[model samples]
Structures are given as C-alpha cells and as structure tokens.
Target: MKQYDKKMIVKKSNELIDAGFELSLNESRLILYCVAQILPKQPIKPDEMYFVDAKNFSELFHLDIAGVYKTLKNAMHKLGDRWATVIDKNGDPKEIRWIISRQYFENQGVLGIQFHPEMLPYVSALKKHFTQYDIKFISRMKSSYGIPIYELLTKRRDLKEQTFTIDVLKRKLKLEGRYSAWRDFKRYVIEPAMNDLNNEFGEFDATYKTVKEGRAIVAVTFHYKPRNKSIPLFDKQGNPSSEAPQKRWEEYGYRSAFEFREALELSETHEFDLTDAKEFLKARGKPANK
Candidate 1:
C-alpha cells in the first residue's frame, strides 16, 4: 500500500480546542486550511491575507466542486460573526472573533480571511500542549459533530485520560438545549462521532468511560493513543468503512436506535430498546441484518 501523506498539519492551543464554538463542516475546513499555513515559530501578520479557493475546499472535504464556490462564500460571510470563548492569561473569559476581515474574490473563485489580533495567542507561537492533527482525518467524516469530536480527542492524545463534565461537553460542542437525555445524546451525538474517529483517524484510537451520579451520567473520560497507523480513507471501491453511521447500525438489525424506536412508536425522550425490533422483524418472517 502506498503511504498516506498528510501535506498540511493543523495546530491550535489546548484552550482553543476546548473552547465553545459552533461551525458547519465547510466553515471548519476553511479555518483549518488557513491555520495549516502557519509555521510553528513564525509570526502571523495581521495585514496578511490568507486565501482559500473553492477548488481546494471541495477537494479537501470531498464536497461537490460545482457547489463549493457558494459554500465557500457563505461560510466566509458568516465566519466573521462567529466567536470563540477562551479563558485569557488572567483566567478571565474573553470572547474572540475567528476572523477580523474576510475577502471575497468572486471572479477568482477564492475567499480570503485575516485572523483577529486577539486570536494570536491561541493559533500562533504555541509553546506547548497544542493540539495537532492531520486535516485529512476529518475530510471524509459526514457528521458536523465529527469535526469537534476529532479535535477533542486530538487535544488529549498525549495524556492517559482526560475527563469532561456532561455540561462542559455539551457547551464545547454547542449542543445546549438538545440531547438532554443521555440515551439520545449518546445515540445521536457521541456514538456517531466516535465511529467516525475510530475508522477515519489514523493517529489514535479513542474510547470513553462514563461516570454516573447515581443513575444519571454526569461526565465522561476519554482515552486516546495510536494503536494502528494505517486506516485507508479513500479507495476505488468507496468511502472508508465507517463513513456512514446508518450502514454500521444496520448490522444490528436497525439503522439506529432512532429507527428502532420509531418502528414501535417509542418516545425519543425515553431509552432505546432494540428487543422489540428483533421480535417485530421475526414476526414478519424476515431475517435480521447480518
């Protein structure tokens, strides 16, 4: 097998990775492309305009090239309003903009972004404990939650384990007011993100242990370190084996707990039970998925 070469490396401070922010997959890719250009010890000039082309964006994220120009334009236009909440050197929370300036070169099919001066401490001149990873790891991931989860795991690849409170996890991922139930949270968010990482990412293997306060899950501890170095991301046949969450879920005789619940008219707010699904399929003389 030919070795996979990660041409662009992305690095960010640990604080930034754990910071609260919500961005579409395209928006995340655009930011990463710009960050990958930074040299470890070099200075990033505020006046310097880094450019991102639709063609490159499409190729990087496996997006449709024809639609990428519009995608790039929209993400760039909205990125200026997005902010990251970081704890400053004095341990006070400060909200920082992701972009100080955005340039649209419509005819050139490219967009330019200038980082905010406030973002300098997190993105540049990082001395230690910076989260670094191959951008390709998320290129084929289909879920929005996949991107942040990958970053969360990458940030702790050096440690034996790092625990995150359920509240903190929800805040960092911007999942507030949603997935209030643990089952729904795990089924829809956590599991899919972990599936994506375990299959697509090559640098490390990630797994988690849940901590419960009585019967309620209150926190999670994530563990990571490289187990295998080679995981084929793209090949002639198709996307990586774990790219589609539904396909993986099919092996258990259901697309997912959601579908299994839907078939029996169970509440999404309630726990997901697949037992009825198996009996339901058997009653119809249908074999469950192998």
Candidate 2:
C-alpha cells in the first residue's frame, strides 16, 4: 500500500488543561496521529469518524505485526474508557470522555473511532489560546510522562518556567494515587522523563526545583530551555565520535602529517601508514617532515 506522510496536531481544550486528566501516553499519541492522518485539511466535522487500516497504523508508527495488534487492543480496551473532567467559565464541572463510539474489524484489519462530539470543536477549528504541537515531538519520548510534561512546558515556554502546587502537579500528571510520596514521584516519574527529554533534546533541556513553605514542600518549579538544535560533536562518551569527521583540510588546519596522526591517535582505532599520511599532508600544503 502507498504510504502517506503521517502528521498530526495535538489540540487540547483550555478547560481540559485546567482540569487535568490521565491517559496511556503511548495509546494517546498513536490514536491522535492516526485520526489526524484521515482528517481533512479544513476543520474536522463532528459527524466525521475515521476508519484506518491496522497495517497503515503499523507502518506510520514503525510497529511490527504483533505491535500493531497489541496497540489496537490497547486502544480499544484502555483508551475507550478514558475520560477527563473540565470546568467551564460558569464554574460548571463537565466530564469529557475521548471516544464517542469505536469499533474494530478483526477479519478486515480495520479500526474506526469517532471522537466525542463535544471534543470536535476543541480538536478542530482551533483558533487561539490552545496548546498545539506537532505529533513528531512525542514520537521518540520513552517515558509516559514526557509528552504531558512537554506539552505543559511548551505552553509556557515563553515564561521558561512553570510552578505547580504539589496537588495540582499530581493532577496534571494524572498520578493521583500512583506516587504518594514526593520523593518517589520525583525519582521515578519526574527524573526519568526529564532525562529522556534531555537525552533526545540536549543536556539540561528540562529541570525543576522544589518550592517549600517552612520546610513543608508546597510546590515545584520547572524550568525548560528550547532543545539544542545543533548537532553533537562527540558521542555520549567523550570520545572521537563515529559521526563523519570534518572533511576539508582548512576545517581542521593540520600543519603537518604529525598533527593529523596525533588527531587519529585520539581514536586509538584508526590506522594510518606514513606514505598515506605524506600524500594527505602534501595535498594540504604541509610537508610530511615539517
């Protein structure tokens, strides 16, 4: 089957953001990406439901047959039951669920889902004050918390910081009962997600500090910087990286063959002969002896 470039927008309601909710990050990302693929370029209509082949979803996400099946089953069972609670300007609380209806065709290898009718306006025809981001940002994220934290941080990227009360933080992470102790939450949840973010984005990509009131931890302050877009020179280890080295002689400015040899010595694995080194030096206007 011809594969189209899979792209999607993660559009969340302002009310939903304030209310906070939980989701299996893995399933949520996959579902949003799949739905976005079938959506028209214009605003999505409430009546519209998307039907996608299991094979297509697998290809887009680079999942194997088993993974595809597992993802479908997870989506059908797990995500179908997920819901969010939000409050309106009138201070009325609303319970918002994800899917209005869903079906899976096993023999035909198809899954269909219609997002809740109320959600269409939020996910589609988004104008302003919405937390919107490309689907690609979360694709490589390992931890479930990475995407949620990223979304929250990116929304406040201009401020370069976010402060949440301990309770509010738990709600945002949907970890109400999971990690009761602050230490456990920091170690297992926050640290791992930040590490993964930095690993993929850059060192110190997202960091946080505790806020305390008279020794009682009240809240946490999260600070983030834009991902370092520059390419890395060395690998994770401080070694001569395998990535292709500078090609131009001017780039390195080796004065003699000895300098070139010295550079290669750092690698300790690159082999160089005198004759080959001589030719290289001559081409760069450096004498082998000098």
Candidate 3:
C-alpha cells in the first residue's frame, strides 16, 4: 500500500465530518484511509461494499459489520433522507443492495462507480479491517437531480414570505383539512429542503428586524462567487480543451426581504379598496392572502 499524506487525510476527514458523519480522530483517519482507497476508481457499489445477504459489511477495520451498519445508519439519519438508502434491484426489497443515498453521492461528485485514482490506497487500507466481509462500491444507474430546499425557498421567497397565516398557507398550498400543516411544512418542506441545499452549497444568513409595532420582518443573505478568466480554447500543445473562461471573479451578495405576517395584514387593512367594499370586507375577517 502507498503511504498517505497527513494533510490529505485530514482534509478528507474534515469533508466526511462536514457531510454529517461523526467519528473519533482515529476512526476518522481510518475512514479517510478507506475512502482514499475506494474513491480512486469511483464510489463503490453496494455489492462491492457488502455481502449479497447485506448482513455483513466488508472488513475495513476491526469493527464488526453490525457496528459499521449502525455507524452508517446514524450518519445517514443525521444527513436526512438525502444521504440514506439501500439499493434494491428493480425496486424489489428482497434483492437488497446497500447503497448510499443518491443526493449525498452526487454532492460528493461521484458521478459513477469510478473514483479518482488518488483515493484508492485509502480504500485498500479500509478493507483490511473487513477481510471476512465482501463489499464493493458500484456506480449508480440513475441520475440525481433533486433541488435543495434552501434554493427553492430562495427562488420563491415571495410565496414563502407571504403573510399567509396558518390557514392561508394551508389553503393556498391545497393542504386544508390536514392537521399540523404548518408544523409539517416547517419540518418536512422548509427545514429539510433548505438544509439539504445549505449542505450541498453553503448556508444563507438569516436575520429579522422590527418593521412596525407587533410586526417583524425576515431577511436572508447569500454570497455567490463570479467567474473571472477567459475561456481556454486549447491546451499548450494546441489540442482542444473543454475549459471555459473564468469570468471576472468576485463575491456577489444577494438579500431577500419579507414582510412580517402582522405587517402584511395591517397593510392590507389600511389600503382596502373602496371599489369593492363587499369583497374587501369579506377578506378582512378571512385569513391574510399569501
């Protein structure tokens, strides 16, 4: 096996930690070693990483297969649905294949079963711990394309920020009659989705400010880096190169502002249109518009 550099190992370890996997310093180092070995060719397939029965993981350390499964499970749960799953052949549960969730894999840029060659030696080291188990990393057949919640929220801030009270939000989203709709939206829709995006990219900074009596507004800020160089047309040898030019690179900031629910209600009340008194009155007692 080739010797691994301490800095590279540390960097890889940090990446795994950031991805929501928790391990001790020693365990992290070992995991990095494993990742380096398998990442060279590409992400390992379920079959390549585990037995057909899916009961035992290939020995990558002295840890037992069950213990490895528990660790993976905890990590996946922490990362949410985006990083958890077992691959099944033709959606058949019986044909089980242990695989990392698609979003997590793609975010790591593992487009196929192959990993960069530089990662192989670490994987080899990891395998030493699970010599009794049979596991391999395989390329995924389907493409991953789920957008993160944060991106969706950022793109549709107008709708989300609308003062639509619980009732209004439920009705507008066609979620009426569902109990705990607001909570559901916050937990399943807004938080998870946004968290996924933040994890993939970076988090948006959120802030709140008092806009009026009994009302507060919310805002989010995002930082984007612009390209900076001219596109490269060819390599030094005059061979065609696919590299694109770097446009002027700079940090661009964007801020999204939203009115408080109470403020929106108050604004609507004060600016009622006399042209339709009846309709305006009806809206007065009803939930605020989104």
Candidate 4:
C-alpha cells in the first residue's frame, strides 16, 4: 500500500475553530487527519462524497488495523451526534449536524463520509478566508490545546501579530471552567502547548506574551512566522529552495502548486530564474542579505 509522503488540509478556520464543538483528543486528530486525505485536490465540488481507506487511517495515525476500525467507528458515531452552530437569517445561532450519511466498509477497509450539504459554503472552494497547513506540521502534536492554537495562529499567518483576550481565548479553546485560575491555565495549558508547537510542530515558531490590565491578565498576544531555519538560503543547485516559494504561494492564497507556477510564468520577469528572484525579494526585506 502506498503511504503519504506529505498530507495537507485546507479548511476555513472559522468553521473548524469557531464552531464551538468538542471532540475527544483522539477524535479531533483523527477527523482532521482523515479530512486531509479526502478533501478535493482542486476546484472543490460541493456535492462530492469523501472516502478514506481504513488502512490510510491506521498508517497515518500509527494504529493497528483493528484499532483503526474501532476508533473510527466510535469517532463517526460521535461526529454524527454532534452539531455545529451557524448564524441563521434571524441573526441567531442555529445548530446543524456534520454527517449527512456515512458508510463503513470494514471488510474493504474503506469509510465514506458525506458532510451535511450546508457545510459546503464553509469547506468548499474556500478561495479566500481559509487556512491551509500540512499534516506534518502537527504530526507530533498531542495536547488537546495544540491543534486549536495552531489553527488560530495559522488563520492569521499573514498578519505580523494577533491577540486573544484571556476570557475569549478560554472560550474558543472550550476550557471555560476547566482552568478557573489564569495561573493554572498558563502553567498547565499555555506553556506546554506553546512548547509543543514551537519545538515539535513543523516550520512555524510561535511566541506569545500575556497582557495585563492592572493586576489581572487580560489578553494573550502571539507573534508567529515560519521558522528561519525552514527557509533555506539556497539548494545545492544554487537555486532558491522550495520553502520560500511555497511560503509566498501560501501567503498569496494560491490553492494549487500548478497555479503558483502559472502565476510565476505570467509575471513580467518570467524569464529570470524564480530562485534568483526569490532571493532578490528576500534581500529587499532585509537591510543586508549575506
């Protein structure tokens, strides 16, 4: 069986992060991992049915075959029973379930999931206002808070800075009563999550500061960007490496690699090797480029 070299997920952060739904750590990781495999390659079709082989789940999640089936079985049930809230015409929140229908072919190692038709607007095309990240970025992430924080940061990837009020942050993280004390939340949740994201999660490095209003901590502000190490100065061919080009494509919201290449072709300086151009652009960003 072929294994994925790299997996990617593209989702509108609002739906995944702001839906106010809860899932077990295992379920959350599994669902997002599965979604990465099933999402359309390009020109997303709203009515399309997405399928994932159980083997793919097992391999991706590093679980045994039987474990994959059992976990997915339970995960699907939870997903079916849960609801996501969306604002209705009256400006009130309305709840909708995610699973329109599902089928598990245990014998064939395949599972088919059809999302509710209503979710297409949030998950389809997603030409704008979407977050795209590679699964490798979170492969080592384990804490429940890790993925959500990662999503929150990635949503503002182009921004130089973003802040979340302490209360609002807890609300978004669904830890309303779990960590009543700011000290406990910071000691147990915030610190560890930040460490995991910076050290284990791929390329991006995030650092945050807590803001205080008088004696109380009011907000948390994060400064995030791709790691300087991940952006290689040059490849062996003396060409700009993939990292910078990929980052530019991501920042510009190019959905597909082909589109990014095509855009480069249409530029007036198309004849120049993009590698040199990329290096030149980087030089412009700094006082000096060694």
Best model per lDDT: 1
After superposition of all CA atoms, the RMSD between model 3 and the true structure is 21.3
> How many clashing residue pairs, candidate 2?
0
Better of 1 and 4 by TM-score: 1
Per candidate, the number of residue pairs that clash is: 0, 0, 40, 0
Candidates 1 and 3 compared: the better one by lDDT is: 1
Q: Please write out the lDDT profile of model 1 over residues 165-251, one tens digit for every residue.
A: 889989887788989999999998888877766775445577888999999999988787655422222111211222212322256
Alpha-carbon lDDT, every model: 0.69, 0.59, 0.28, 0.61
Return whichever of 1 and 4 wins on lDDT: 1
TM-score of each: 0.72, 0.68, 0.22, 0.70
What lDDT score is found at residue 127 in candidate 3?
A: 14
Deviation from native of the Cα of residue 153 in model 4, angstroms: 0.5
Q: Candidate 1, residue 138: CA error in Å?
A: 2.0
lDDT of 3 at 31: 32
Residue 158 error, candidate 3, Å: 18
- The TM-score, computed over Cα atoms with residue i paired to residue i, of candidate 4 is 0.70
Q: What's the candidate order when arranged by decreasing TM-score? A: 1, 4, 2, 3
The CA lDDT at 267 in model 3 is 28
Question: Candidate 4 overall Cα lDDT vs. reference?
Answer: 0.61
By TM-score, the better pick of 2 and 3 is 2
Listing every candidate in turn, what is its Cα RMSD in Å to the true structure after a full C-alpha superposition?
Answer: 17.4, 15.5, 21.3, 8.6
Query: What is candidate 3's local distance difference test score?
Result: 0.28
lDDT of 1: 0.69
